[model samples]
Target: MAVKDRDRFSTTTRIRLLGEQTAARVYRSQTRRQARRSRLTSRAALLALVLCTLIVALAYPIRQYVSQRAEMADMVRQKERARQRVEQLRDLKARWQDDAYAEQQIRKRLHYVMPGETGYVVIDPDAARQSRADQGAADRPWYSNVWDGVDKSDASDQ
Candidate 1:
């Protein structure tokens, strides 16, 4: 029994036992470090996923907000254009209210000559190919247009 106890307490046996225990402790510490690293990695991946989801969820509303703002700006511009057009129409209406302006437009557009006033039109060779007789309906006569309309209707029937 003393011999067996001496063998157990021998330097070689003690060194072997200490080495085994140290090896086991080192292995356990490495395993725990790996577990902690894995947990950190998983947490980081979860955080990244959450951030991506939030960005994706907000993307459409953000895009819509920008586009709606642009649409509103376009509408404002259209409204301003419409307002300007209305003002121009109002000014034109005021101009037409004046008897002189109305008379001038009628005379210019219809080529009218009041009573005995002579009206002459210079024919331009480079201008439109209007017929000499149809240069101005007023130049000929009102009855001429009526006759032309009747003639055209009669020709179409044939």
Candidate 2:
């Protein structure tokens, strides 16, 4: 009977020890899971921080590049306008070189009359006095006054 009692007591002690070991394993597993969760959260936060930093670093240069491109496009448009203006001026210069156009401009500006055409001059006394004064300043040839009169009329017309 004593032997049976002793065996029963040993069995009870073994079962209690096994239960304690199982509880300890459960606690260790829970702590390991909590540690893994915290580690993953920290890694996610670090990834977000790196992404934000990259965005901040690149933003200003990208904006500047876009603005510069727009300015370059505007300059190109101005160059095209200048080129067109040059072409128009070239055409005007060509027209001025034509003999008939040149003669027409001269006749209109100088009020010239052809041979056998009557030419009239309406002189203001004050201007005539000034011209006579200017003529007295030099001992010029007689034809100089006639040429000067023609040039004066052309300049006044313009």
Candidate whose lDDT is highest: 1
Error of 2 at 27 (Å): 8.0
Candidate 1 TM-score to native:
0.63
Give each prediction's root-mean-square deviation over alpha carbons: 5.6, 11.6
Local accuracy of candidate 2 as per-residue lDDT tens digits, 34-129: 999999999999999999999999999999999999999999999999999999999989999998988787666566767898866677776666
Candidate 2 ranges with C-alpha deviation above 4 Å: 1-36, 105-158
* Residue 30, model 2: Cα distance from true site in angstroms: 6.8
Worst 10 residues of 1 by lDDT: 126-135
Tens digits of per-residue lDDT, candidate 1, 54-152, equal 999999999999999999999999999999999999999999999999999888766787999998877677544767455576665455587888888
lDDT of 1 at 136: 70
Residue 72, model 1: Cα distance from true site in angstroms:
1.2
Best by TM-score: 1
Candidate 2's TM-score: 0.47
